[model samples]
Target chain A: MTLIVWTYIVYIALSVPLTVWVAHTLHQNGRVFLIDSFHHNEQLADSVNHLLVVGFYLINIGYVALALKEGIAPADLRQVLETISRKIGVVMLVLGAMHFFNIFLFSRMRRRALLQRVPPPVPPQAHVPVATQ
Target chain B: MNHLYVLFDAQCELCVRCRNWLAKQPTFVPLSFIALQSTKAERRFPGIDALKPSEQLLVISNEGSVYRGAHAWIMCLWALQNYREYAQRLAHPILLPFARIVCELLSRNRFFLSRALFKQEAQSVARLLAAHCRPPQTLCSNSRASV
Candidate 1:
């Protein structure tokens, strides 16, 4: 077969499993944070988690497929390896970026939830001044 | 803008150091520091006894809410950039009593701890103040003749 065909095969073979592994890891680890962020609403947290994982898969798989077309078709095995490495590197960076973005969103949500639960510190009586004789 | 006012004992070296540390933290909400003995603190929070300032750490929110001891410490942490998780964990039911006990222990012995651990920092602050107050030679000589 041609180098282009091999490149597609190698890319898909490597990318799909990597994407699945990362999504699974994020789903597992992020559940606790999401639960806390949603104020211990387990159903809401689980639904959000499932939605995030689905979105992650769609974005990453779509990117991998779109990015499979090389600028220059590889003529030799060395060229093929170099192109694959470059594509994989970009995919890895995109995955990392997505992970951090999700974390940032969840952290902000958690902070807001915490603020909501915190009781107001001062009583109305404390604001009143006493008359001095 | 919401603000958290931290009332600290200015005389305690550790308290001063802690204030400096808290000042450096990235905060979600602005934090204002006031010495419990300061006239400003007295004016802002009337009827609180300032004589025993080291007894508890007090944090007053902009909404007029007051948090004391461990709760005040947790509020301070919650206001910090990345320490919110720790604040949440400490506020948990299982850990809250422990947090309170630790806060109480620290509050009761802070003066001694300050002297033992932060004497050098206190001395440095005194030196810095002294340097600021020192008159320039030319100004001092000119003013001396006027006097």
Candidate 2:
């Protein structure tokens, strides 16, 4: 009915779809990376992929809900659009940050697993006769 | 490598204590410890002294490659399941010189550290381990700080 209420409506409408779209994109594309990180364990990778998407939805949607009432009361239609734009911009940034954080976490896990195959960094000084134990 | 032989100076209480601790850790490659001049060490590597095992740590891979001092310490950690990443990080060119300095400092001052940290029966046992090894030195000959 009021401008602020209309702003909330528009913000939610924009944010929920953006969240779903980002989650779907990440879930589908991140599966390949997760599979590789998990060393080709598709079952495990899919499980993790689903879990990550669920968490991403929860955090982003919760943030959107919490941040809904943050800005000053909108006086006019122009002000309403401005508030909605600001709110959605913050949500997009948060999503981008979360995406980068997830990539960092998974890459660290993959690096640790891959370290098992890495050769010794330093070479030996000499050679000794192998003694039969 | 499948196995490693670590040669350490038995007379140093700190080294002996470290050997026992290393033996208990879970490792990717099994570790076998040998006192530098023990009968078994002499029999296994007749020219062990040429490598100067007493001055620093020595690790002999099952394939016969010998790693000395700081490199030997890194090899030991690399063989461990938990510390392999740490060893790799330490082996990075940026951190490697620091690792070498730390290892050399620890090796040179190990006896002093042992006297300060360990006064238990462990020192006596270590003394009995190698009769020919360097006699245990007094801690901080200049400083009067009580350990």
Candidate 3:
């Protein structure tokens, strides 16, 4: 009915689907990384991946909702466009940051898991044969 | 390796304390601690005395590989769950020498460090508790009798 209402409508329409798309992309690609991190346990990897996506969605959508009424009510089409663009820009930045944070977390997990398989860094000084305990 | 055997100086309070602490930690690989002077250590590794095990850290894998000194300390950490990353970081070529120096420093002055860090505080705490928390003579006698 009003420019402000149109701005809200456009903002929600843009933000929700954008969030979903980014989430879907991450879920598909991050599966492999997660599997490796969990040492090829697909069931555990998928469970963790789903949990991470759910958390990501909750945080991003919650941010979008809370940030909805942040600025002055739009009075014109230009104001509506500006408000929507600013809101969408913030959402995209949040998404980008979350994506990178997720990558960082999974990489750390993979590094630790791989460390478990690594050989002792230094060679032993001597070998002593012994009876089994 | 599935298991590690750590030989520590039982005579040194700090080494024994460290052994106790290491024993209590959650580990990826199981650890067995043996006193360097213990007959078990002697039986398991005859001539272990010749290696001067009391002077340096010693670690034995289940497969019979012996890691001495700095490498032994790193192997000990590698067996632990939380310290494994630290062990790996310290094992880097650049850091290994530094780690060795640190381990040697701790090992060489362990008795002095133990006196400074553990014994003095423990004695102070005991003195404070003794002064502040004296039991009634009757209760003390009753407790002793129960024991």
Off by over 4 Å in 2: A70-73, A129-133, B9-11, B16-52, B80-105, B116-147
- Looking at candidate 1, what is the lDDT of residue A61? 91
- Classified by CAPRI criteria, candidate 1 counts as incorrect
Chain A TM-score for each candidate, in the given order?
A: 0.88, 0.85, 0.95
Q: What is the TM-score of each candidate against the true structure?
A: 0.53, 0.72, 0.85
Q: For all candidates, state DockQ relative to the true structure.
A: 0.10, 0.43, 0.49
For residues B1-147, write the lDDT of model 1, one tens digit per residue: 277888876656677778889999988778998766455565666655532334788887765566788888988887886676678788888898899899999888886787677654546544432332233323322221210
Q: Which ten residues in a row have the lowest lDDT in candidate 1 chain B?
A: B138-147
* Runs in model 3 lying further than 4 Å from the true structure: B120-147
lDDT winner between 1 and 2, please give it. 2
- How high a TM-score does candidate 2 get? 0.72
lDDT of 2 at B48: 67
Best by TM-score: 3
Angstrom error at residue A52, model 2: 2.0
